[model samples]
Target: MFYQAKSTCLYCDHKFTTTKVRMSKTKVLKRDSDFCIHYDGPNPLFYDITICPECGFAFYNSYRKLSDHQRKKLKEAYISKINVMNMVGERTIEEAIHTFKLALLTASIVNERKFITANLSLKLAWLYRMIEDEAEELRFLQNALDDYIYMMAYEDIEQEEVDEDRLIYLIADLNLRLGHYVDARRLFSQLITGKQVSPRYKSLAIDRWQDYKEELEDGD
Candidate 1:
């Protein structure tokens, strides 16, 4: 399931080989209602971020191409600031989390879109969750939820056409987890009653909303 693929750093043009997981080799053990994947084989999540050994420019699939200004910033801020050579080779789960953290830092440095930052943060949270590190998991989850809120409220997110329903469901679910029951109920109600929401998400939202009401009743 693992294969070595050649990657050229967008910032430095440094060529390196990185490991990638073949989808065929992975079996999904389960999925959290929030759509987090639990894999039976080598988890593909660990290998999503590619770190350029020579330049320390870490990125993921969404950031393969870079503008000239972005490249300059990465070279100056990322390459000059870190020990790039230390990140080469196979990554342990801890090392994988490190790479994602670095990617988040770089994303922040470049003023990346809120959606990308939130996604990277969420992935880091998921990685921490995989290791059962509750503190780190909650920390990153909160970061992600905050960014998701900003993206919805202030930023012009393109996902409005792509997966807005899914995004709404995510916000609702995150609110529920973070104990924002009123906001959760509001978003969940929107998803459940909206005409365009997918049947799958609608069904899931209905179930989660019922559970939330029961929890509220129990709290009373």
Candidate 2:
């Protein structure tokens, strides 16, 4: 289910082979409400972030190409400090978490887009959920929620492939998971009643809102 792929480091231009999961070989078991996929075998999410053995620059496909100034800054601020680890081959869940954390750090150091950082945080949260680490999961979920909210407020959604309505629903769901019930309820209501929202996400918001209400009633 894994194959070696060649990658060039964005900062150092080091060509290296890295392992990736073949999605065709994996079967989808189910997805959580937050859209984390469960697989029958090795999870592909573990291999999504590629880490450079030379410069320690970790990134994914959606990452923007580094400018010359950004590269210089990365070298001075990050590359000079850390010991580069070889994360080239097959990875365990813990190893994946390490690479993801490295990618998040890289994103921050270079001022990567909020959308990309939000995705990295969300995936990191999902990895923590797989390990039943509730504390870490909620922590990253909050990071994702904050980034997504920032993106919605100041960034251009048209530039990215992300659907705005779905993003709103995700923000609302993250609020729910983080125990921010008032914000969750208000955002979910916005999606449920918005005239311009897509039917698919609207339906999803309604379903999740109903589930939350039912859970509250059952608890009482």
Winner by TM-score: 2
lDDT of 1 by residue, 86-187 (tens): 555566899989889988998887778788888998889889889999899889888999998999888776743437788889889888877788899899
Question: Residue pairs in steric clash, candidate 1?
Answer: none
lDDT of 1 at 83: 80
Taken over the whole model, the C-alpha lDDT of each candidate is 0.83, 0.93
In angstroms, give how far residue 146 of model 2 lies from its true place: 0.6
lDDT of 2: 0.93
- Misplaced by over 4 Å in model 1 are 86-89, 159-161, 211-220
Best by lDDT: 2
Candidate 1 achieves a global lDDT of 0.83
Error of 1 at 8 (Å): 1.8
